[model samples]
Target: MPPHSLLELHDITREYSLGKSRVNALRGVDLSVSAGEFTVVTGPSGSGKTTLLNIIGCLDRATSGSYRLDGEEIGDRDFDALAEVRNRKVGFIFQSFNLIPVLDVAENIELPCRLREEGGRNQRALRARVEALADAVGLRPYLHHKPDELSGGQRQRVAIARALITEPRLVLADEPTANLDSATSQHILDLMLRLNREQGVTFLFSTHDPRVVAHAWRVLHIQDGKLLSGEYPGVSRRASGAS
Candidate 1:
């Protein structure tokens, strides 16, 4: 693992048994992510991109090899330990918004804080936080609206706010732009980039879109269940500028 890496995976491998056969999702994959970096992972379908993200986010354990978060070994931790780590240190954004249809925007954003029991944030504070996040994502006008009442883009903005509600050290987004149109996708990407710069929040995402990759400070390319490139250095200007 590199020095100052907040997340590290060393020779990690994950496999699932399908009847008599074994399907390897990841093989000897190594990666390190540092603080304040926006890293994008891209590959073809069935290339283990989502699997890798799940492992890194502590949502699933690896079959073999060492995985570390903030220098703490996570592969060997129990389920409860992993859940705690995820709740306190990691936030997740998915392509499908995943907002509760019955919950209003502010309620959805406050769900993480409620789960963590980090009280002392009275309704006023919570509302302020939600308002600030909504303003940032342009969702302030829909605070009382439920998920079913909002458009796909609005729901996604609510999801982003919910992900950041916990102020986690790391945010993992899987195909966040997949549900939006081109214009909305660009807007959301810009929001994420600005948040990364302003809040110094680390971000890792799995995406196939070149537009998404263009916003990243680093890019990892995976092939055949292995990390094929993006081991050293960060994003290149030429690559960033490429269409």
Candidate 2:
């Protein structure tokens, strides 16, 4: 892996076993994401986009080949080890907004720090961080509200804040805007783009939404468990005269 590469995958493959058959979710995927790159992997349903993101995010392991994150070889780590790495190095945002229904916005954003293997964080400092992230994601006003109390866009904002609170090296968002309306989706995408640009956050998204693809800094196309070689680096909505 290059010194500047935040993530590298070499010929990665993943397979699943059924009662009497097998499934190939990924095959020979070679990818390297440089630090702070806002890249999106796009494909139709069942195109392995989610599988690839899962492997990269450490939520799942590959059946073959190597995976390096921050120059560390972690593909073969056991479940417990992987969990540790995930809590320390990766953040995730999901389409469902995955916020705990009972927890208020502030508590949800602060959850990751509490779950860390090292549990001696200062309460004052953690609260400060959570509040800062909430402000950054436009959730400061909703800090005391539960997930059920916010609108769809505001809930997604909370999820984004939660993902960023850990300051993870990588953030994997799986179809994050799937439940949002078109206008709300654009707002969410703009928020992500701002975060990526201002905080140097590295984001990898798996989605079939053309609107999301339109905003990506780099787009990777996948089909049949293989990545195709077309990228629109630095091309986006602005280039197409769309506001």
Candidate 3:
């Protein structure tokens, strides 16, 4: 295992039993991601990009192999334990910007702490953290605005703030820029890159978008449930013509 790796996967495989035949979603995937690294996994629609991200994000389990998150092996944990690990150590930013429509920006960002009930039960400190992240994502001015009141970029920023609210070791984004326009997608990517640089937050996201892949410092190619080694910004066997 690499020292201080936020995520480590060894011989990871996921198989779904389809009647009598089995479909492999991931096959012997070995990957290591260090803390504070910005990495993107890219592939075609059925190349298992989302499956790998889901496993890394603890949303699903593997059929076989070891997974270490923040120095702890969690692959064998039950659903409840995995849920706890997710709430405590992992954060997610979805493509749809899954925010509560009625909750304002601040409330949405502060939702993680409320769910965990951590931080020594100190509301004041949590509020301070939320504000700091809001400022970092440039959402301070819109902190009181509802989701519908903000632009797509602004809503995505709010989601980013919420992801960081738990101070997680890893943030997993599934096609985070899929719902945004080209310009807004680039803007959101820039903000995320800045966060990774300044705050030392590790980000691992999956996408088919070449624009987003181009911005990653480290690019990984996944195809047919395997990790491919190459000199990227090149496309994989399954990808064509830049998304």
TM-score of each: 0.92, 0.93, 0.90
What are the runs in model 1 whose C-alpha is more than 4 Å off? 1-3, 119-121, 231-243
**Where does candidate 2 have its weakest 10-residue lDDT segment?**
234-243
Clash totals, every prediction: 0, 0, 0
lDDT ranking, high to low: 2, 1, 3
Candidate 1 local lDDT, 34-140, one digit each (tens) = 88788899999999999999998888989999998987888999889999999988999999988888889999988888887764558688778888999988988
- lDDT by residue for model 2 over 15-38, one digit each (tens)? 999878999989899999888778
Task: In model 3, state the lDDT of residue 105.
Answer: 96
Which ten residues in a row are the worst by lDDT in model 1? Answer: 234-243
Tens digit of per-residue lDDT, candidate 3, span 64-99:
999999889999998889989999998899999999
lDDT of each: 0.87, 0.88, 0.86
lDDT at 135, model 1: 91
TM-score of 3: 0.90
Runs off by more than 4 Å, candidate 3: 1-3, 230-243
